[model samples]
Target: MPRYFTDEHEWIDVEGDTATVGITDYAQGQLGDIVFVELPRVGSEVARGKDAAVVESVKAASDVYAPITGEVTEANGALEDDPALVNSSPEDQGWFFKLTIANKSELDGLMDAAAYKSFCDSL
Candidate 1:
């Protein structure tokens, strides 16, 4: 299992120093139908807890935060053509980016799945 989560409701699956990042099921459910996703450029530097991208739904736009400090490696370009993948598979096909983490220690500040669930419950 992956240690994942952010206060912004982002989820991350870290593998070594690289990670795949995305929003949570609860987030997508609230966002409704995803129509557009503005992804960050590859190689962009992102600070933990800062806005890294934007996800726009039929309802509104929300900032997607960097769960950990990292250099963006790739983004879901497929979102440019079809954004519904976010609604159908927020954890899998809808993953937003892959990152090359700058500081592995940053992971310590993130919440694990159990903690994330608790945090969501509190929200």
Candidate 2:
């Protein structure tokens, strides 16, 4: 699996035609203590670079954008009860949803781990 990131601080881990999406650790840190998450429903279609979900923290609510156009295949129901999981494990259990990719080519527009690290460092 290859993980990619957007400048907006969302991440997607690609495995075959499905991609798991979530906010980055940096994003969670910036958001402060997460209290709520609004996730897209399974079977919903989202366009690349559009808001796919929202996360609310002590600081503010932030949008999580889709890195590629796709149909959502699943949403993490656990988030409704344990939003703090986002702060504890944004890359794993805290993942918002899985999407069946609409266009694989859209993945090329995202930054890899190394590039995303540099991009974060620049902030």
Candidate 3:
């Protein structure tokens, strides 16, 4: 699966119309130790660049923005029980939600792995 990232440090992996969304490893590091995750409800509509979830860490709470417009299909329940999964496996098991993409074109504005890496390095 190809992964895309946003300036806000959210990463999204898309397969067909379904997408898995999460914060990048860099994001978790900045947030410190994660304590809680507030997820969006299934079937909720989300617009690109808008808040879809909130991650609370020892440092502060931060919004996880939707990288593409879509209706949420699922939220990661595992985080509710072990929010620290975000710190340990941010790009894998720590994913926040899945969405059924509403517009494929929205992806064009996002950065690919190479671009995102450079974006992070410049930060």
Top TM-score hit: 3
Question: For model 3, where is the 10-residue window of minimal lDDT?
Answer: 58-67
lDDT of each: 0.88, 0.91, 0.92
Off by over 4 Å in 2: none
TM-score per model over all chains: 0.92, 0.96, 0.96
Q: Which candidate model has the greater lDDT, 1 or 3?
A: 3
* Candidate RMSDs in order: 1.3, 0.9, 0.8
Q: Look at candidate 3 and give me any clashing residue pairs.
A: none
RMSD of 3: 0.8
* Global local distance difference test of model 1: 0.88
Ranked candidates, highest lDDT first: 3, 2, 1
State residue 46's C-alpha deviation in candidate 2, in Å. Answer: 0.8
Ten consecutive residues with minimal summed lDDT in candidate 2? 58-67
Give the clash total for candidate 3.
0
